[model samples]
Target: MKGRNSIQFRIITGLLLILLLSVGVSIYLTTANQKSNLLDASQRTLAVNNEMLNTTIRNIMLSGEAPIANRTMEDFRKITGFLEFELYRTDGSTAFNDYDTLNFVNDYQSMVMFDQTPRVEGRSIDTEDFQQVLMNKTPVISLNEDTREMEYYFPILNFAECRVCHGDDEFIRGVSHFRISLDSIYDQVRRAGVLMAVYFVSVGVILFTWILLLMHRTIIKPVLDIGETVNIAATGNLDIQVDLDRNDEVGELAGRVNHMISGLRERRDLELQNKVIETRLEENRKYLDHIKEGLLLLNSERRITGQYSVFLTKLFMREDIAGLSLADFIYPDAERFADERRDLDGFLEMLFTNKTADMDMIMSINPLNEAVLQLDQDNEIIIRADFLRIVENGEMENVMVIFENLTDIVHSRHELEEERQRRESELEQIATVLKMGPKVFEGFIEEGERAFGSLRGNLTNFSDKEFISEAFRSVHSVKGTARYLDFPGVEEHCHQLENLFAEVRDGSRKVDKSLEETVAGTLDSLDDELVLIRKLIDRFKEFSVGSESTQVSPFNVFGERINDMVKDISNELDKDVVFNLETDLESVPGLPEIQPSIFHLIRNALDHGLEDIYERLAAGKPSESQLSLRFIHEDNWLKIEVEDDGRGLDMPALEKKGVEMGLLKPGVHLPSQIVNVLFRPGFSSRDEATSISGRGVGLDAVKEDIKKMGGRINIRTSRGKGTTFVLLVPWKGDEEGVLV
Candidate 1:
């Protein structure tokens, strides 16, 4: 903190100042060291030279003691400059002088042995250190005062050369003394300081410039380029790119940034396109589902080929329909109905050949009833397929599949055929009944003859009442028939007989024996004719009751129609259904036609035939209950089933429950017979329902009313298993299918 004497600042400041000060001091110290060394060296040289010269000069000046030696002294002096040499005798004199200032007095005293002074002109010394040599030999060293210039003391020492001259006084004689001026050497040391200053300033400037230039080239340029690219990117200009002209860390960073921007742009555009495509696809799907006809698409292998909505899914029932093997999802019988193998092969061939294609395919499907598998009765399944092939994205591809339901049209044809057959049969029966009517008249004539004969012959055990009773019965029959037909002759005959019987009861005697016989005979004759008429009438009534029914209840008409369906059909192919009739289960109070629907269902079961006995037996079922017609009252519904042990309906074949299929209306659950394809226009399960299915109009009509009544129909079977028809019909019908 403090300096002891001359320094003027605090230690911290002072030390820095001192360091600055030391810079020059270092230079001064170096100069001083050189100067001191030179001075000491030069002083020693001068002393030695001066001591020899002092003696030599003394000998030469003492006047020719030896000529040759005197000459040598002059030569030595010339070489030495004779600058500080002096000789002072014991008497005090300048023995030889090369200069006017040569000292023989106090000057010598000023030149100490190692100390040289310019003012000490010629000082000499004789000391105890050189005493012996000084006393015996030539002057080794002399001590004298330099009075001319200054008082100087000289100190001397012995030298070997001087000791040679004074053997006994070697110490003193060998000593020599001289003083040499050292001022000139000081000038050389000062000159060196100037050269060091030049090197320090010049080299420092050059080195500093070189280092800074290197820093700019290596570090600053890369930084500026990074800043420019960042600014461009901030403006959302992803196209701006940086080309760092090097394979270095910075170059890799630039590449990463460019890659990130490219990806973002690509993904954004892709997302937008995907959104639009998805929206349109959803709309198109809805439009397809809205159509009346069911539509489906299948791949080359007959598997469902694409994604569809839940509504579209109704076209096929199972979830695994799409992308599965055709056999896995479709009912087993469906494989045959659709002719799947042929269709699949054709489709694949068309695709591979790259040709446009279209075809109409007929498939057998039990669109309505599921229970009976008679193609003639409820199990008839027929479908029309329309197909097309097209190219997509430059690749041969299958186009859309559109399905149209043709069942109703086919069913209409069946009904027409049934009606024709029914009309013909009725006409035949009418002809037979009419012919029998005449036969009654001929029989009456013969009976009259017999009656008269009976009167003459005497009869026994006869009650008069019995005769009247017999007569009354015969007369009553004729009268009733005559009244019914409005027959004039027959009614008159009936009146006469009644009158005769009345008189007899009153006991009239005018009715004589011959007269009584004739009257009795006439009555008897009429009775015989009436008997014949009755026989004919009996046959006619039998025919009429079963035909052209006046009561068209849904069940009766449906039953009749179905009976026609199984005409000539077999017991093996179509066994009768033992109906589970629910007697207490009444139709809604207002709908009297429900019974007809129930009856038709049983008929449908029979026509379709129980599945084959073999199939039924294998399935652990009775081949006959065979057709099981059940009607159970449910919650507001009459859940009925008209099932058979026959094969199940092939749904894919009869895809559309059409008019030919006996569909009364849309969304209706018809009777089992109408629901089955067995009732198709020309379809007849003659082979299958050997006993029941012959006429084709079985289920086609029944299903119509059932559906209108708000019911559902389902068919189930394994190919070898029996078929079952399940109906869920409202207890109260919609009347749409009901007859007036």
Candidate 2:
């Protein structure tokens, strides 16, 4: 739409259209004229050639050389344009039929010498053009559409010279028929027409280009300039004037527009001067009176000034707030905030009396920053107080205090924190159960229940060495299993039970009611954890039963788990990562079974392979790093690759850590061998452990998992480029060419 409507487009389009039409018509007319003239000239040449044939035949016939005449006509037929040439008799019979014309001429010569009758008969002609020529006694030139040739029949009349050898019985002696093909001549005409057309089109194109340039320079550019100037003025910037200096209508329009802008500028200046003061006063009044927060100014005496926000009175639930002492206004109870009032006094003194006091330090120690005031028995609010210093002549005279009500925000934050913890606990429980597997979790749950039952049964026998030893064994075993299964809550409970039993063994605590209750409480907590596990197991069984009929794919579950893990790791590490999972897990045999190992590799990439936001940008990479996991079927192996565009392996750090861990000798080593040290247990370069990655068990476990599957893993790394870990496992395709 814009293309069709733009001035340049319209001008070029309309002008080119007109030029094309004119040029097309002129070229067409000129080409037609050229073709007509070429056809006429070609026809005249053919006629002259026909005359030459006639003159040749006549000269030979007048010399009484019949053989030469026949030979001459044969030569004429050999010419390129002549398709057919022959002589015919007056009765529409063929004349000069091969050597028969020579025979007839010899007979006439014999009759002239020995008085024999002259032969005038020849083969009879069959064509209608021959008969028409015979009857009309005129030359007939006509086009033959089927043969695409021109037929010419020129009548050869009997003359007195020919009556010397024989008597004249007919007026016409014969007709010379010439069938000439016009293909070559018409082709020449077409070529001339094409050349003329090309000439006219080239001239038209040149004229069109010149006209377009002239229009753009003289008209389009000037109009565009005027439009730009008008648009600027329309935006309320009346100070600008159009600067088109010409003696045309466009120039006149620019002058008028500039005059209008000048008048508008003057009017705007007058209006602004008249209303500036009033507008300022109205804005200030609106701000102070209607602001949501409380505003107040305090003099050195710590008294609220007369100039205060209307909200201040409403915040205190009292009128007559002006000129009130700050202490009374803020802490009306007088006894509840006694210490706060003293701190406020010192804070005010620092702001208004002290000359060299750091304002930042003063604000940091603001006593009323989070002051909770009870307006009524049922109504309480939290307000945060912020202070601004008011200086006059470089001397502090007053301080402005802004009281923002943060009651709703603080309460909402607490609620959000509680919700966040609840959801996090739920998620952690789900992850622990899923990772433990249904059968392993069931075993752990049964073991935990029996351990807790034994501890409960022996709570009264805390002093007995035999019972104490049994209880210690039970608690230790349960704790070990819980820790292995990643149930921190149950593990911690068993640890507490272990501590209580240890105290009993050392005889430092008496086996009284307090001891029994504490031990019983730990047992109860462990029992509750087992109960939650049992419920999760039941839900798992139900889901398994439902999923069989539903036919759920395990690969989708793997993908979702991987997505969640990547998101969690990204948030924990505070890194920007784009995780691209470019694989159809269901299409790769045995891939789903090794998803846990794949998850370890993914987490390692996000945690150790990819760089943080600032580190990436500093290295001239994008702030968001790229991490891709691909599973490809190559040959008879499933090739899995996990890659990252990040700060690559720190070889020196890895070598140093390997030396400290005794995984490598303190000597120069290839980076490949140094990187291989990462697959060893307890080999970590991190000084501290994070929730995402630090224990170094991920890569070690991954290597073990691949080893169990009869697969191998390889690592490729560059200094500052990135790292890719490739895993290849043997796989024979499934029956339907898909993994089950």
Candidate 3:
């Protein structure tokens, strides 16, 4: 509900009220003027009639007692209003009341020679205002008391010329009174009032109609237009302008309203644009934060201007390090140190010149006394820092300083070393359980007895690979237990075992299976001999040592492995499977590692190569298939292409299934390049859960295996034809460059 504007409404209402009041005033004045005119016209006619009647009566009254003729005055009175012919005697007695039709006939109803009304019979004998008509004191006109109907009365006096009857001092006095009727005038006035009321009412109606027209144009129409504008504005439609007909106040007001609306639209647009800008700004800020690695902005003076991420703060531990020279974070006397680094410069020059050089430097980091702040739950304390700057990089302007926290690394190494030792001890304990029988070979001696006298004779030198490998699993157990039981030189014996195993495992030569078997038997006897000794070691808290070794020397090829696989794939296809084998890698260069994963992809290609066996028969083609394995090397990248004469994947059905599974849009166009989404993790279109294809880990695992080696695999399919999978890869793996 909309509330009315009290001030404006009141102003309009007040103006209407004033108009009503003005109309009322005009009607009142008009009614009054009309009433006055009616009254004046009636009064003037009455006065003229009175004067004519009085002149006629005076002639008769002064005619010396001549009989008063009523003819002339009767006519005058009828023409005006009412006339009464009531004569008064000279002695004030009633002579005659001749006009019987007059209701104003007074106490003197007698007909006589004298009458009165409006100064009739102008004899000074007996007038209402004449004092000389008195017999002795000269009486004046006699008073006539008729009903007050605007009547005029006068007295007729006897004249001295002839007094027909006796009269005092030859003066006969009488009176006549005439009356005028105003009923007609009052009727006219009432008729005028009714007409005036009608006129005023009609005028008021006309005024009201005019006001409605004006308001419709000025107020109502404009308000309707504004309402329409408001509706459009609400709907976010900013195109329309209110069209108006006039340039009055309402028009001006509408113009202002339109202007205000335009301003609001502009503001809304501005705010929306600002919101988009703000969102992009926040997004850019996050992106900047993502890649801003250990960056420190510096001014022209090489002073730290600013730093933005947690990495910098962790490295420096000094938020207040700003405004400081860049070299302040370096080793003490960095200025002098930098100057003396010309040797590093010379080595760098040698690097560019391809000349070998080994430049090493030692530097220390001074720690601020402030305690290290710990925030991440998985953080360790940092106490000191030292850097081993080795100049090997030739392109950079700055020294390639490699800072290492040797203390932390060394501590970690110790902990890991302890864990390894404990694991070895546990394995040794398990071996003891496996050799629990005390009656060993029916010729066992004392628990402290060696396999032969002085067991260390054959393993004197631990550095030899074959002897060490055999000694660790065999004699190492005997030695650890012997030490636990206090056998002489037992600790030295176990250390020799550790050194021996390290050499053998890390050696270049491979140990034969026969040697391994031979060592296993010796290990069993040694574990049994040391079983009781291990119990003693547990009581004394002693453990055997552990070590790690790795060797990546080339191993012998399984010789006929590639030929065997090719024969197998071709045999399965039941056709001559061609091998466009790159001669350089006819035998897989890194066959030992790749053979495990490669066989799966190769087998899958052959098994599913049946391209509508019947259709092939009809097309005069062999039911069997042809498969080709092509391998090439270019620019450190190995490209292997696997092709087969087999039915391609049912792409339409696959896409439909993908849609039905709600993983893809109904009309999405699957890319033909990688049409085989079957390579995706856990993907299989084979309907059956269990198949000779192996349960789980199909092409998915193949893809994963390739990916784990930082390689990529892609498949291209052609319907009714065959599919080809291309595997591009790196022969060298991460094992070389791995930080660990």
TM-score of 3: 0.27
- In order, what lDDT does every prediction score? 0.47, 0.74, 0.49
List all candidate RMSDs to the true structure: 36.2, 29.8, 34.6
TM-score of each: 0.22, 0.35, 0.27
lDDT, residue 415, model 2: 92
- Write the residue-wise lDDT of candidate 2 on 1-740 in tens digits: 35888888888888788877887788678767775676667667777878888887898778766656766777777988877787776666566544664567678667656332234335566688888888898887887545657888888878788776556887888888878887875676668767877887888889889998998887788877777878898898887887788888777887888888888898888888769866776787688888877888888778987667889778778877767788788877778878877887787777776668777877888887777888889888898989888888977788889889889998999899867864676676666445434655676677677768877776777778767765654555555445434566886786676666656665767899999999888778778778877887787777665343453244554455566667766987899888888975455577543554666677678878888998888888889888888988888888989999877888898998899878999889997789889887545677654544564556766776688789999888898999999998887577222111
Candidate 2 regions exceeding 4 Å error are: 1-533, 537-548, 584-593, 634-636, 730-740
Candidate 1's residue-wise lDDT over 376-412, tens digit each?
3344443444445555787745444444444567678
Better structure of 2 and 3 per lDDT: 2
Which candidate has the highest TM-score of all? 2
Better of 1 and 3 by TM-score: 3
- Per-residue error for 721 in candidate 3, Å, reads 99
Clash count for candidate 2 is 4
Residue-wise C-alpha lDDT for candidate 3, range 1-740, written one tens digit per residue: 23365434554676578767876787678767886676566556555655566556666645522233455554555664564444555555444333432223321223542443222342222443322333433322222224324544444555554354334564445555555555665666668777877787787778766776786766876877787887887787876677875688878877887887898889989999999988886775465356423444444344454343434455545465566654454322456657424433433344334324333322211231122323245654433322222233543222222223244666787789867875666555444323322112111224234533333354344356444433333333333233322232343444433443443454633455544444444444445545545554443333322211221222112222334555654654454555433335533444333433455566566555444456667766677556666667667776777777677778777776656644566676747523545654333455433222422234655665577678888777777677788877786622321100
